[model samples]
Target: KDFKSEEEKREYMLYLDGSNSWILKPLNFIYNLNDKAFFLNSDHTFEDAGTTIEIIRRAFENSKNIRKSDVNSKAILIKEFVDEKNAKKIKEEKEKYLKLSAKFSCNDLHLELKNEDCQKFSKDSIMQLIMIYAQYKTYGKFNSVYEAVDMREYEFGRTECVRPLSVEAVDFVKLLDKFEDKQEIQDALEIANNEHKNRIKSAKKAQGVDRHLFGLKQMIQKADDKTKKDALEFFNSMGYEKLSQNFISTTCTGTLDFIGYLLFTPVVWEGLGVTYLKTNDEVIYLISYHEKQKENAKNFAKYLNEGVEKFKKIYS
Candidate 1:
């Protein structure tokens, strides 16, 4: 403990650096909660600062279900479902809502998968596709879906302007229940894979419609009345009822490989964040969710494993 006084740390925070809420959720914690085996221990050294920044940027950038606004400029704000939810809480109700929502946050589960079992679907496809399918089967509903994309190949003003590789992966998930024929199944997979590939391409080319609208939304929020109303109307048409549950939910941590020297268990603020990682022979599935409110992290993890197993029976 080198710090002799609390004032020293306060100086560093008050003047040296300060962050707003926009960057709060992904500030990157170096320690664990109650000595939990969640964080990537810096005890094992690395050549670059790859693990932290890349994982953080990829998750946040790629998780948007972008919708466009009426504005001509790239400054049009994209309204999300959460933005439309009429959370009209009074003073006392606000306190209660906070307490209730807090209870459902900060949770995770650890599981493993066989690489061979995931062969046909590939690691990314099988994990996302199966998870969405399970949610549909379990909830029997439609909602928005988002996934993170790595946009390192393209250039942005920043180090790497990456975003999520998002698509309506749920559409493919629905196909699983719709058809049993071999041809139908093959066709669905092709469509799903094609959607996945296209999303990556769109994001890399800076044609990410969602975030572009989100940026517009940001500007309009501070703009005059005439522009804001039209922007709000565009979002109103989309409706907010489907937001009660996110399809793919939050894109916290995607895939990580620290030369086989990293341990990752990402925490999700919405629905769930699937952290796909691996060791020598085991593929680790770390599902992070809020506390058990409705369907939780554990059941999602269970359903996903079961969903994959059923697929294996047919394909393998």
Candidate 2:
């Protein structure tokens, strides 16, 4: 059944207040009558994307061929895996002043590139190149880049941030903008890819700079007043400001068979959030941006496609 109007759709969906207390509990199944879509909403405080995906897969397997009425009766019990005290601490640490904003719009792009074009490079490297080039073409300059790195190999771990804009990456994107020689661009790409791989390795080992600095800042809050003041001053410096902007936030979920797409709002109003899934022959991306922002998701997707085509020619 379709919703008669937007108001009816909102009335049918589960609405939460500003507190978002409902998110603290178990999973929530929200159905949108307008799009006839179902969404599983979970808090990041409890489960990360990897665990959530596994839960969804299990629920899907259990519900296969089952009656619609019986589906609700099938309970998927998750264990008490999260440490309560730690979870509470994490939740408390996240409390901040709220500034409301308008909703962001997203565009989805599914592109199929010839395997040979990307065969020489890692999927992640290629994606990173395409993203950097797209950003340059869209905004005419480089910005801080963030790629989510899963840290679940460690106990009670969630994710760490990998800043992908290395000196080599910057050089490569510059060369890309200038239409440099194919050999020069290819060499720069390899160097950038290597740097990206190193960053991923460091983040996976929980040695990334972001989390360590975050933890240090949290510790500073409990330090002596003078120490805390000094630390806060440095944290508020322009150097830190630029690092924290994260104008290009991207995450690649790899080729998850169950996931058709992923969407997330940009961390900043003027930034872009990109989530991509790469399969054997195709790469699918969901690019999100605030409507008020100068950059358009549709236009960014166009630049991304152009970058892909450029890569095809370079490799050929």
Listed in order, each prediction's TM-score against the native is 0.57, 0.77
How displaced is residue 100 in candidate 1, in Å?
8.8
- For model 1, residues 1-316, the per-residue Cα lDDT tens digits are 1334433322222122212222123333332233332232222123113546565457547545444453354544545343323434233455564454444322233445576655555456655666676666655664465555545554442222222223446555665666567566666666776666566567767665666655676788887999899887765454432332234543323344322122222223545545454333444454444555236555666676666665555454
Best by lDDT: 2
What tens-digit string does per-residue lDDT give for candidate 2 at 144-204?
8888888877897889988887788889888876766989988888888888888888888
**Which regions of candidate 1 deviate over 4 angstroms?**
1-122, 152-168, 239-247, 250-256, 259-270, 278-283, 292-295
Error of 2 at 315 (Å): 1.5
Evaluate candidate 2 by giving its C-alpha RMSD to the native, one decimal. 7.3
Off by over 4 Å in 2: 1-26, 31-37, 61-102
- Per-candidate local distance difference test: 0.48, 0.73
* TM-score leader: 2
Evaluated at residue 65, the lDDT of candidate 2 is 73
Clash pairs, candidate 2, are: none
